[model samples]
Target chain A: SCYLIPNKMVPGDSNKECTDLKGNKHPLNSRWQTENCDECDCLEKEISCCSLVAIPVGYDKDNCQKIFKQEDCKYIVVEKKDPNKTCDVSQWI
Target chain B: SCYLIPNKMVPGDSNKECTDLKGNKHPLNSRWQTENCDECDCLEKEISCCSLVAIPVGYDKDNCQKIFKQEDCKYIVVEKKDPNKTCDVSQWI
Candidate 1:
């Protein structure tokens, strides 16, 4: 599974380039880009990224929490169903 | 005014508490919560937070970038208007 690795956990040189899940190389200190299910950015050696999922409304909060929770990552309510206002996690690029 | 202060920049005690925009105090390490237009979390002395705003789907990316850009912050497409597929920043807690 593709996920973000924090700069502190990154070993070796701080300026080392980063490889996305697709094996695409991103230079150091570059803005985040989506790779597979993750959207990530690199700053120095630290990288911050969030997983992308298209969840429907009425999804269990606990389940969503469990599915999306990871070290240094968070699962937020990024979208909601219209009119009904159910939780949604669509839109990733 | 209420924004995250990174742990490294925090002076003196490392376990100092955080104050939200509404003057509510959070412990040293706590999950993020919304205060006004910001959603913030504290880890040690470093705080990570994002400003919140409702934007339409057709909202110009450049304009949105200019409006929400801040030091240590990046504006993302967190939500979109359903049906019409407009940008929305609703649902803050």
Candidate 2:
């Protein structure tokens, strides 16, 4: 299940802790979130995540290379300099 | 301002609605969620999302093609047949 911890509760050490809908305290720096098929680490106030799914079947090697050239390939390209960068939740604050 | 709606509360229509910490109701099928740099649609019980960030600045055309190779390239590959697919929350249920 996903947990929605407030940005404020994430960086401070206090009795006021964030919790999931179940009311369980969501600890800081916990690897508790998932996105798509990838697991994520819940850091100070962000979720650092990445996927490890292999290239699509049949579209391997040269085939994958060829497909990557098509205009539609733009949709699949990873534009982030670091695709695994932490997703700052502080922005929501 | 992320909402922690229970998976059960997501699929049905009732007086029991989900809300963020602010106590505002999180409507179903709303484009209210986001991941990484992408906005997402909050569907019946899932988050349908995708990224629109342009394929990195410098690494365009042939340069991007070259980087698509190499073992480390696997780290940035988008392997989901459809990366824009909805993330089913039922699994969390």
CA lDDT, every prediction?
A: 0.43, 0.32
Which candidate has the top score in lDDT? 1
lDDT tens digits by residue: candidate 2, A1-93: 112222434334653333432234555566543323444454554334444322222222221121111112111322134323322221110
Docking class of 2: incorrect
- Give one digit per residue, the lDDT tens place, for model 1 in A1-93: 122243433455556666543346677777664412346777564455654543233444442321222223433442222212424444322
CA shift at A72, candidate 1, in angstroms? Answer: 26
Candidate 1 residue runs with Cα over 4 Å from true position: A1-3, A6-12, A35-37, A52-54, A57-93, B1-93
List TM-scores for all candidates, in order.
Answer: 0.25, 0.26
Pick by DockQ: which candidate is best?
2
